[model samples]
Target chain A: MTLKAQHVSWRRGGTLVVDGVTLQPAPGSTVGLLGPNGSGKSSLLRLLQGIAKPDSGTITLDDTDLALLRRREVAQTVASVTQHADTDVDIVVRDVVRLGRTPHRSPFGGELARDERIISEALEHVGLTAKADRLWHTLSGGERQRAHIARALAQEPRELLLDEPTNHLDIRHQLELLELVAALPVTAIVALHDLNLAAMFCDTVVVLQHGRVITAGPPAEVLTPELIADVYGVRAHVTRDDYTGRPTVTFQPGPPKGEVLRPLQASTSVRSA
Target chain B: MVVGEQGRALNALTLPVAADSPSRRERQWSRYGAASVLTLGGLIVLAVSVGVAVTLGPADVSLVNVRDILLNHLGLAEIPVRVSEDAIVWQERLPRALVAAACGAGLGLCGAILQSLLRNPLADPFVLGVSSGASTGAVAVGMLGLGGSSLGLSGGAFLGALVAFGLVLLLARFASSGTSGVILAGVASTQLFSALTSLIMFAFADSDEARGVMFWLLGSLEGMRWNDVGLSTAVVGVGAIVCIASARSLDAFAFGEDVAASLGIPVARTRVLLLILTALLTATLVSIAGAVGFVGLVLPHAARLLFGQRHARVIPATIVLGAVFMVWVDAASRVAFAPTPLPVGVGTALVGVPVFVLLLLRRKGRA
Candidate 1:
């Protein structure tokens, strides 16, 4: 149930995409990864999922070294919904979900009765059951993203990983999907660009800057005007909302030159909204 | 306490899902059933075509005589026929027709495998230069007196085909664009091999030798014997079984490497195995039939359109459809031109291009 990485580093070409980062998500906890573009969120997720090996470090799922396990073994325990999962050929949504049964399937067996149920349940969870028969190419961008999520959910894995799963979603769908992810009874690590959604959904938040972990804690503790001003360099109004008591980050409607970086990490004044 | 309601709601919501599933499964199974029926129907057409194709030729053999000859050979029934007519039907025509069918089936399977493995709809064995390379080898041996017998020509062609396959792999490895790079490399190798073939034909061979080489290049089953039939049957039969076993691997490849790897398929190993197997299949067919064009490329698409994108259905359908298409094409070549033997390859492309274009147009129209 515990998924962790220790001092992981990965280099692509001449640049260090993920540099000396360690992550450990608590069992059954949803961890939100907050990072600017090129800050290594996707790279870190790839390394954690055992799709790409880190140059110098170790990854373990449930205390077992991930590199030691076969791809099938890793896939059986860990499922991921990446941002860029598209096929050139024509396939239906249900068939795409059925692919999640790969690790559980026998070498020569047909799609089993159990596999079909899981696939259907995943479709139902994503509210894509009605669109199951539609060709993949005919799906809208947000629907495609949801279909990928359904495919990942069909795996019924102990750990679920997603990278920017809400990229193409409309506002309503974005909220619904985050709600669904938070409600799922499995460990999750989601890379998110939205601080408010992360604050509202994730139990723990980790922020990355320039391929390094800058800060990590519970969302209420970690999110601050100082962190937002420092990491994102945008003037953001930080406050505790009356109902949820979660720290909400709203960018102030002003020019970038209107704000200055604060000196101390814990020194930002917060106003209740 | 709040989470408990949604959990209960999710479970309750999925119960009606149970009500919806049986009919869906039935629909899916029936679609698959229809695919199987289509394949069975194709097999029947192939059987009938083979029987009819054996009767079609310059030889004036009656349909009843053709039937009696076939039945007598099978030991199902006995009827007397002239030895000459029996020889024409049994020794000459039957083996040729069967060889056409086997070559067709093998090439179609290779085409489908190549397309899936490469994740490119337009990809086929010929796109990898296997056919061109085989022609170079066969021409070098058969026309230039390098290898005296047809057997030597076949061996030379196979070796050349392997060379082309290796060259394409090496070039594609160095190239950055991966699949597209492989295709570019194949085009380069095909041009190189085809030039070599042309050079030998013009500079080395006399008129009669050149004509014989031309016949082989353009694909004629004129002198196909029982041995060719037996050899092709063994190769295509074994190849079809291998393809069927590998169907799941092919299915995983439709989405590309990362997704396929996540699906527990060994992407690199499977790609290598599929490419090599398909190359071997194409090479075998090329040696026997001299690179019969279009069947390998078009029939797979036709099969997929008919049977759906699943390789499980497409593979069987392709085999049957390819066999039947080639049988009719060969028969049309034999009878339409009379004493002037039409190259089956030319005839295949002549019919294939229009039909393939219509299929493409129809697919777009459907979309």
Candidate 2:
């Protein structure tokens, strides 16, 4: 089943936060949502998750209209992990992950053995099995993030959506987390700020700017110097790695806007202030 | 097929309520075993407290006689007693004790729900200004003799409590910060109602009349009937069911609003419904017994420590603990001063301090 949005537009507080955006992710592919801050990436992600409805447009999952699905139906099919995870009260990691079973079971239902097995398996996938009994407050920053991942994993959705998954990770964790996401066999739409990491991990990448898609394609075609400069307002040199064959982006250290050359005389004829 | 979406949710889990703090003390027991043990202990204690508390009031009644009276009423056994003695046991102390338990359970349930729903540990049954409003209503009836004494003080107080609840929600809608905003609105409304109650008392009540009115304002379980016991028990039972049903979603709220919505919970709907439920619960009890404070605020925390923070444990545990606490507190309130009894609310406040302090210390030590 595929997830596609056609000409989606949204207005929030007098501003068109997400304007006429279209997202078409190949089924079972990891597609990156790349953008500078306030480029409507997060808002668009929210729209995809059905947390927000488009003013005009259609989001279809597996050819079914997303608007027609109940909240639990959408949740069981698509799990959205936002940018924050916390609980005011103290609880353990296992119990937190167990919440993924919410949409699957009724409020009065018992915690089935299947639920426990799935939770443990999710914890294993996130490499948090050892820390399953750890209290929520006792987790390290990265561990907490991982636990959130475990919780989402336990939801066992057909499609997973994440907003900036590596924002809190160190280099190693960012790499590990991206690697894990890339290897997973489900459709994924990840909103990422790091261009190079997106290049390395995403099978497809879509760039957003001013609430519109500036460019979208395979990383090799999408990660060019001009696209970077135009979309991010940053000048960068791009190269393809010899072995991995993915494009490597190195931003030039200077004024973000391109430095253009101008013809000048040796004599100083500049205006005096 | 569904198993692969873990990748999709990579960045989905919002802000790291950073788990930077290291484990304080590892859980000493398995949650299953601990939960079962706590449940058994709570229920047993509740039963024992109910049996023993009725015997401790001003009238002379032995624990065995109290037990026999309760068992006989339950149709479990027939241990006969004198008619007046049976009346004192069955009609007087028994219902009072039972009402105390019901009020306790209801308040505890409300406290737990509000604390979790609002993400504020200090929340209680009266956080929405229900008590203040009820007091205003009851006092007006007592002072001005409104409704000619037929509708009586409780009816007036119930109406006032409902009005205050409506106002609190009205103010909550305008508030930008959600739970804290609601609390601030409640505080403002409470002060306003309290002042109005004072104005009414000043204008209409004499010294003796004011003193009589003041007792209801403080709260009492002195005259509860079997009907009061039944109604309060029913209210608490429904509240507990609702709370338990929403337990998993409440866990989602522990993180924040975004997380809860992301989990597919109808956050706005749940919050409003729960707020209304707590308001109704508080109003019902306050109408019957003034504003018995502290039990709602303290018992939930005590339950949390005794059982864990998971609502599955917290909900049921709080109900039983609340019942146990209230029965004894009411009993003490009746017997402590002998011929001159204090209001149960006053007794609760007196005992609540040390109990709350102990809970805080235990939590700190565990941390």
Candidate 3:
């Protein structure tokens, strides 16, 4: 139940998109990966999910190198929900969730009673039980994201990786989705842009700048005004909430004064959003 | 913990459980039962269609006679019959109809697999340029006499198809990657091979030779013997098994390659194997039947409309629908022109396009 990335560096085309990054989240904890665009959050998630190997360094699950394991073996331990996961195929909500059982099912074997119960539970967890028979194309964007989460949950993986699962969600769904992920009894590494949401939900927060780890610690410790200003090139007011005792970040109205922080530059970085 | 409690409260309010509904296992079993019934029924219909179609044509053979001949050939009975009737029933029509069924089934399966693999609704067997390559090969042998009589027309066509598929693979590799690149490469190869076919026909072929090639290109089931039936049936049978076994892999491809990889499918290996399988299947069928057109393009969609989109069900359903549709289309084409015969490809398009348009409209309304 351990997933660790050691000195990982990944290059896309010619640019080092994920450079010398290391992440080791405690088991059964939710870790938030926060960075501006092209800061390697998604690329790191890809590496963590075993979709792509880091150019240098190693990714391991319980001391086993990801490359050494078969794809099925990796999938049984790790499940990922990609950003903009979509399809034009005429599949229903339940069918999408049923796909999560792929690594477990024999090719010729039908769904067993156990698989069915797990699928139902996953749908229930995502609050999609009522729309279980709805066609994928007809779902709203937020519902689609929930369906994807449900699909990942159906995999019953020990580790779950999600890239911006709340992008299409409204404010309420954003809170609810994060809450759901946090409550799940599995290790979760979420790459997100919403700083406050990450602060409220994540047990630990890791910040990336130029594909390098800037800092990693408890969100209250890591999410400082200076860190937010340095990483995102903006003035952000950080305050501890009286109720939850977590950090809250509020961006200033205008751009920063002088060259105190440089806005993210357009680069030849080939990290797909 | 308050946030978590709020989330739980929201879930309780919004996500009601359909507690009394049938479990997914029960639903899947029912679907399987339905598919089994459909397969059994399709098999029955296919056997009946072949039997009834064999009795048709200029010969006045009866359904009873066709059955008796079939049973007698299999050593179940020894009913006395006239030699000409036996030749017409056993030797001529039976093989042609059976071959048509096989071609239909194979092409439909190929279409279903390609559409899934490419994640495009428009993909089909001919999209890989195999049919055009086969055409060029047949023309080169028939018109230019390249093989002189050793490498027959079918063999030449098969070789040509493989060459075209190879060029497509090479072009897709160099030009770009992914399914779109392969499709574009296929288009380029199809145009190139089609030009070559036309050049050979116009430059070297005599008028009669040109007409003969034209008929074959339009797809004819004429003069089909038992050997064609055996070859098509064996190839298609094996291909169907391979496709059905890859059903889960195909299902994983609905969200493109990256997601499929995340789902634990070895996307590269599975894609390559399925693509090569499709190319070989398409090439073999075209070489035998000269690129019978619309069945490959239209039948899979029809199957999806009837049986939903899962490949495990879609692949088998497409095979059955394609076989039955071709049997009837070939029979109609044979009888519609009296002494002269209509090309089977043209007949399929004439029937298929309208049905395809109807399917498109129906699908659009649902969406």
> Best candidate per lDDT, number?
3
lDDT of 3 by residue, A78-159 (tens): 9999998899998999999999998888788876666777788888877899999999999999999999988898888789
User: Which candidate achieves the best TM-score against the true structure?
Assistant: 3
Runs in model 1 deviating more than 4 A are A253-273, B1-5, B8-38, B76-78, B143-151, B176-178, B199-211, B358-367
Q: What class would a CAPRI assessor give candidate 1's docking? A: acceptable
lDDT digits (tens) for residues A202-243 of candidate 2: 999998876878789999999988777666666799999998
Residue B235 of model 3, lDDT score = 94
Task: List lDDT for all candidates, in order.
Answer: 0.83, 0.82, 0.88
DockQ result, candidate 3: 0.41
- Return the TM-score for each candidate structure: 0.89, 0.89, 0.94
Q: Interface root mean square deviation for model 3, in Å?
A: 4.7
Q: Chain A TM-scores, all candidates?
A: 0.92, 0.91, 0.94
Tens-digit lDDT string for candidate 2 (B1-367) = 2334544444333213322222211222344457678778888998888778877766788888877777888899888877777899899888888899999999989998999888888888888999999988887777777777787888999999999999999998888566788989989989999999989989888899888878877889878899998888888889888898898778778777666776777778899999999999999999988898898888988888877877888888888888999999999888888888798889999998898898889889988
DockQ for every model comes to 0.34, 0.27, 0.41
lDDT digits (tens) for residues A152-202 of candidate 1: 887777788999988999998898888887777678999999999999999
TM-score leaderboard ranking: 3, 1, 2
Error of 3 at B313 (Å): 0.8
Q: What is the lDDT of residue A73 in candidate 1?
A: 84
Q: Rank the candidates by DockQ, best first.
A: 3, 1, 2
